[model samples]
Target: ILSDETDPNRLHDLKDTLDRYQVYDSAQIDELVGLYLSGADRDQLDPILDACVAAYNVGLDEDGQVDFKGKAKAFARTYAFVASILP
Candidate 1:
């Protein structure tokens, strides 16, 4: 409300309120970043993202499918070794 130019009375004397500073944890953002890299599917991550959006009141982009990509690259050096190791 402090940023709102129209609401001048929204600000209250800090003395009347708590005298301590509050710190918010970043676990939610950290989890989201980690989960995104762990090959989690949309169905599993949507709920988490929804909760984040609600709490932060901001828009977030849903992660794309892991199986799809905008461009393809050839890693010929390790392809044979990796493909052979996997069942």
Candidate 2:
């Protein structure tokens, strides 16, 4: 599923999101999707997620606006529905 990336500029923002602004902000879900577009030797999803989990702005509390588990479940449902419709 690899394709030549036409958006190198956006990929460059990954480090800033993770390092520079993590104390005050969380990386957007769409920003994380950039990992696939990065074409790096190994996907850094696990480490990135772990880092995000540790980030102060991610707010894992029950009333938090950012919900990693909820996002995962939503992705699962969307993927399942799309796959079911595809074939």
Candidate 3:
């Protein structure tokens, strides 16, 4: 479990609650979201991107990076859930 732009103590608390599962800080999570968003199919990113857009209500960076607080949590959940289910 991880959270973007979340306090490190709170994130540590969350990880502790989840059997001490490793929790990534915002910066680490941002990288994952960036990679996923950049390489994934546009269709796959649509809902996530839309949700981010709705949350931030701002234009992306000139380099085309979407910036939104806590957006990485969604990606963390996606990765966590998928990884948990797969062998």
Candidate 4:
């Protein structure tokens, strides 16, 4: 998952990897985010959703659900968005 960090390598790199791999599509991403959000610690999904919003300009619902449609376009847009924010 992507996050706010003080590390040398930006978490955006990981999102890039996922994009390059084409493994985690929107459905998958939504599922994972939902899984994380469903817990008591919903805040844990904040940075992750921020990453998605950065990349896709799409925010999670108030209930923390990610729309899984248009997986590639959303992911690519989000990927570029996050990449732009890095460094």
Candidate whose TM-score is highest: 2
Q: Flag clash pairs in model 2.
A: none
Instruction: Give the runs in model 2 whose Cα sits over 4 Å from its true position.
Output: 1-31, 43-47, 55-58, 62-71
Whichever of 1 and 2 has more TM-score, that candidate is 2
Alpha carbon lDDT of each predicted model = 0.39, 0.48, 0.47, 0.52
Candidate 3: segments with Cα more than 4 A from true spot: 1-38, 58-87
Compare the candidates by lDDT and give the number of the best one: 4
Q: Model 3, 24: alpha-carbon shift in Å?
A: 15
Q: Model 1, residue 45: displacement in angstroms?
A: 1.5
For model 2, residues 1-87, the per-residue Cα lDDT tens digits are 013433333334433433443333345455557875786434566666566667644544553434444444444554455466556
lDDT digits (tens) for residues 27-54 of candidate 4: 6578666777677365665665566555
> Candidate 3, overall lDDT?
0.47
Clashes of each: 0, 0, 0, 2
Query: Distance (Å) between predicted and true CA of 68, model 2?
Result: 5.3
Better of 2 and 4 by TM-score: 2
> Residue-wise lDDT of candidate 3 within 57-87, one digit each (tens)?
4444432332222334544564565567558
- Sorted on TM-score, best first, the list reads 2, 1, 4, 3
